[model samples]
Target: MRPDSCLSQVIGMTFDASVCDMFCAWGAGATLVVPARRELHRIVDYIVDRELSHWNSVPSALAIVEGLGQLVS
Candidate 1:
């Protein structure tokens, strides 16, 4: 990841996935974008608005987004 890469922190800090999210960005000096409460319901909008370059999450989380028809090519 580049220093300017905007990586999304979709998982909570309590979860193990969050560790990777943080380290991946911090290790490479990239930007880690954490979503707010309001933005949670509109993940796609937040992603676009934030211009996220990377998103890290579990398969189920992705399934939720895909099921919502929010995953665009």
Candidate 2:
């Protein structure tokens, strides 16, 4: 799919220097959510609650989700 056509795609989790790529690569309608606090539980909660469409980050992030028993299948 052409990134230009992928509008309304939401992305922007962490700043690993790829945020720009995330927005440009995925097109518009994507807003980066920089958590007010760097709390693991809070972040995970949001991720699970919102059911964020796309999730891309380091392994540690996934580890926290698993540790909190939040990974859904």
Candidate 3:
């Protein structure tokens, strides 16, 4: 089980995700995670493509995933 990082932030915060990742990386000192986009399909694709077992995201994300044919129960 891997925790794939989603680099999503408010509309004006472009570098916040990278900054957040930097902190998360510095605390552990490694790049075990990769940044992802905030788009509907892109976000869902990350979960499905990476085969992630767990995820925490906005309701829109789940709705998009469900609309795209949810494979999980």
Best by lDDT: 1
> Against the true structure, what is every candidate's RMSD?
1.6, 5.4, 5.6
Could you tell me the lDDT of residue 63 within candidate 2? 79
TM-score for each candidate, following the candidate numbering: 0.82, 0.48, 0.38
The global C-alpha lDDT for each of the candidates, from Candidate 1 onward, is 0.85, 0.50, 0.47
lDDT of 1 by residue, 1-73 (tens): 9898999887888887689878999999999888877886767878889999998777787777788899899
Better of 1 and 3 by lDDT: 1
For each predicted model, how many residue pairs clash, with residues at least 3 apart or on different chains? 0, 0, 0
Q: Determine which window of 10 residues in candidate 2 has minimal summed lDDT.
A: 1-10
Clashing residue pairs in candidate 1 are: none
Tens digits of per-residue lDDT, candidate 2, 1-73, equal 2422222222344555455535654465454344344434565566655545455555777777777787778
Give the candidates in order of TM-score, highest first. Answer: 1, 2, 3
Of the two candidates 1 and 3, the one with more favorable TM-score, higher being better, is 1
List, residue by residue over 1-73, the lDDT tens digit for candidate 3.
Answer: 2134433322224544445544554455433335344433456566566554434444566677677785468
TM-score of 3: 0.38
Poorest 10 consecutive residues by lDDT, candidate 1:
56-65
